[model samples]
Target: MRSKYTSFTLSIALAWGVWGCAPSTGTPHPPAAVAPSVPTSAATPAASPVTSDTEAGREPPPAEGGPLPSAERAGGHEPPPSRFPEQRITLMAVGDIMVHDEQLEAARLPDGSNYDFAPFFNQVAPIFQEADWLIGNLETTLAGAELKYTGYPMFNSPDSLADTLKQLGFTALTTANNHSLDRREAGVLRTIEALDRAGIQHTGTFRDEASRNQPLLLTKDGFTLALIAYTYGTNGIPIPKGKPYLVNLIDPALIKADIARAREAGVDLVAVALHFGNEYQRQPSAAQREIAGLCIQYGADLVLGAHPHVVQPYEWKTVTLESGMSHNGLIAYSLGNFISAQRRDYKDVGVILKLTLHKGENGEASFEEAEWIPTYVHYYRKNGKRQYVIYPVSLTLAAVQQGQKDPALTKEVLNTLHRLEKEMKLHLDSLQKQEKAS
Candidate 1:
């Protein structure tokens, strides 16, 4: 298969605040798509380099070879200089993790009883590990092997996928998507069990009402963040009777309530992962813009969206809350497919969205910086065997431009890379024009 490389300018910005939170359970319902008037902009600004003192929450480095100072020195009362404490955390998010039949077959082990997906992610593991928390959309169900492995129309993947994700340093996953109910209630329950076993936190779907009632809370570097996920609908599959809480749906009221709950819980940041958008479309639909604005209005600090199966533009908005307070937030309409079998233009490309967050001495959390690295999924055969790997697009392009050949890359891949690079340049130019006009 051919591939493409693209280039786009990254924006950098100063600090920003967090959002509110709340929780609620509900049945699956389709949200009407409404086109909202909004302007498209480049991705959020790149994160500033975290200073050593801020990152380690420590005072300035002491003089080399010098003894550390103490409160009491030489039998006299000597107080150390006072300094405010600060901490920094980095978060990375990606698009859908879809395991199609081709992927499942590629992962089959020699024993035939299991599959190993670890190899597929090895190339990108270092990038993922660079962030303090790595998050992604789990678009397939790990309902166990008893139900048989399938893909596409309905997905039921082996539990090994979850195991691989956990080993790759994924801190959490958003399980709300069109395929969440492909295996029915049993599938949902088993998926949750598998995630729990892997020690990865998840949101959007739950095995029980009680679990659904609670928010997914994560604490790191003196900052508390709450994540909530919701999907447009469950692909026409009715949620189990009286168990509307099984999968989160796109409902503005419920989402706002969840945000309130997160705030009430004293979370420093609230992020909403929304699985709603037109599939295979490079541009976000009207409904996406509407809901994104609503999310910001309801106190969401960051909105990460998915399900378009293709990367979409990013927008930054300054919203005014009910109390007349203004907040700056970001929205990534669609992250696209992180990994998949689809070969359509843009379908095989995605991005790793990274954000830097800082907590000040006053106990306030804010967004420090935001940026993304484009990625491409490479499918090739090696040693008479099939292999699937993801590569950073920029690196791949650089090697090709240098006339270096990779065994895993093909002529088609080079052509696709060039095409993507051209397209991205045009897209960025368009955004710049729009910004100038605004």
Candidate 2:
């Protein structure tokens, strides 16, 4: 799964310690170096973790950790402000979150009575409460234990995953994907129910026409984001007869209408997340570009693409509207897989796309800037037990060299990370790739 930039300041990091199956110990390293508008081989820091005492739900604990401390303390007050100031809102989004059979095994305890996914995301805690809002793609189904838990071709994970996602600070997620129908209509309905129980907002697949007709508008710090999601298809799974609302299929006209309606609604921003692209392909196909462009032209401020299972190109460009007005929009073709047992080169690599958005009191908005933090999942065997952890690549390398102080072991880990980081560079900043594709 892909990740986003957390600390442009390059200093925040989550404290590290051992947890049952949660992302376990290491010296807390700063986040990855912030990747600029162009994904160059630069270095910055990443993460802001608050160690949580509680796991999502496998076992009960007192409660999760507290929020990060604010810059201001008690008795502190803001200075006098000028008129009509613009508010800067930071938005964070990650790529596909697919739990394969191996991941299920890793999350399952020795007794196997329950499954816990909190450990999988605990290491990334700094991102938990920092962003104004965060988004992730639930690329599997939480169709309940009554159904056999499986993966890959048909993914039905435990409801506990939603508890962890809620504990991890995900305000919203897009559930419309090829896996939406993995359990058919039951999967689609149960998944949303789980999200609701977790108090998380979701878009894309819907339970009925009224739900499908109503657009999903997420409000944060008074700024609203209209989230519209659709998929290319459901891996040959047929939408139940007379139940088109069960899944959102990619349709240019429908996509345009949705964006138009959101625009008309006066929301601060419109983000269309499309789960379309070839699996394991390092680059987006020509069709991906055309569809992305159409969304931008139709008034979408951002396009969050996924399903490539690898990082694809991203661009910020000026989009001219039919009314002769121009606005900047971002098209991130794919964020890649955020967390999974997919250990193949790029499949194990992903990024967190962090965007800075500015909105003036006058109601004008702008896509101020973009940054990314690369992530690599480390799946291994420890004491004959399978373990998996996601690390911010560059920062982990730095921590090992500076803190671990084990030359031989550090060298071994660094070799693996350095190679992965280099592989990430090849797929980012693809203006040249875009030109060629055109």
Candidate 3:
């Protein structure tokens, strides 16, 4: 009856690439346990002074109320007066959205038949109102009540969970994770249908070959993003013989081909979601680096990863084009759990990975800024029933200290919040040095 979360942030330029150490889907193994760190991330706080990342060597943004710079031409082109031809959009993403046994019990109606997951996400809604697109990992399957609504090892949840996500402003979600097949092929199909009824966009799992073959593209403000997702495996679940298209497993060749096709389709950006890496680990493994590096090399503009169920470091890698123009791709190895019943320290953590992406009249992608808001899940008994609420870590801590009283803000909870904020700062800061060093 406690709390959980996920998140990442990045600022980088566009380039072609793809990567993730391919985990074969032919086998199914139990997923590793996550190490909780609470909430999500400590992005610049909305309650405090605005914090911006404009490091040395990075160009200062154009003066406000003035014209912006246009895209630079290769050798023979002239410098343009302004960047007026470019369009800007915002993207926000998070880590795993999990349903545990306790949550299932908590959401069950007093009538004992229906479930209402609405109260769990209200606090986090305002923050996402302006995002051009809101994406997250739907870690559990919407396999319906006939599946008995289980959790963890074989997660199946009320279809209304998808409705809750839609109401929460989730424009899209990735479905190819270790637990994607908890109920096997039927679960995957029903999950897709639930999302459909909720009017939510999803990638990763597909019910038909044609759906698998088609690209998942999201367009807004004159820019389009092609998103592809691949999990290492379905916890060793052999993807139902002859239904290879049912779920997206990590296969470099297939990914390469997919990215190639996305590029051919002329999407403004390609974001690859990878559900790999060791659970409970805060750092990405070498194989993770290899996979991410390959994805960036294969032309992915943004690489969002998960499976660690805890926050991990992010990177902005520079890739030079044949014409010598320098561009960097974003690689957030893990965003942590978006929501879960996990009680571990860091595993309880997550962030709302936010980015400001720009597209030129020519359809080139560039990044203006990135941010994350650290969040934590707060669980407590209400009217004799257990409940959970996700709160921004720093903002809530500040309020609690300033006399905002809440029954669940125990000394232990405050202590954990302080530690999460401190650690997250140190963790995210290291990325600056990492990018600079690279």
Superposed by TM-score, candidate 1 places the C-alpha of residue 292 at a distance from the truth, in angstroms, of 0.9
lDDT of every model, 2 decimals:
0.76, 0.73, 0.76
How well does candidate 2 score on lDDT at residue 96? Answer: 96
Candidate 3, which segments miss by more than 4 Å at Cα? Answer: 1-85, 320-327, 360-363, 401-403, 431-438
Error of 1 at 66 (Å): 12
TM-score computed on alpha carbons, candidate 3: 0.80
Q: Which candidate is the best by TM-score?
A: 1
Regions of candidate 1 where Cα sits further than 4 Å from its true position: 1-11, 14-84, 398-405, 425-436
* Residue lDDT tens for model 2, 46-163: 2211123232122223235743323233455543454555466778899999999998998997898889987777556675566788999999999999988998889999888888
TM-scores of the candidates in the order shown: 0.82, 0.79, 0.80
Superior by lDDT: candidate 2 or candidate 3? 3
The 10-residue segment of model 2 with minimum total lDDT is 13-22
Candidate 3, residue 377: lDDT:
81
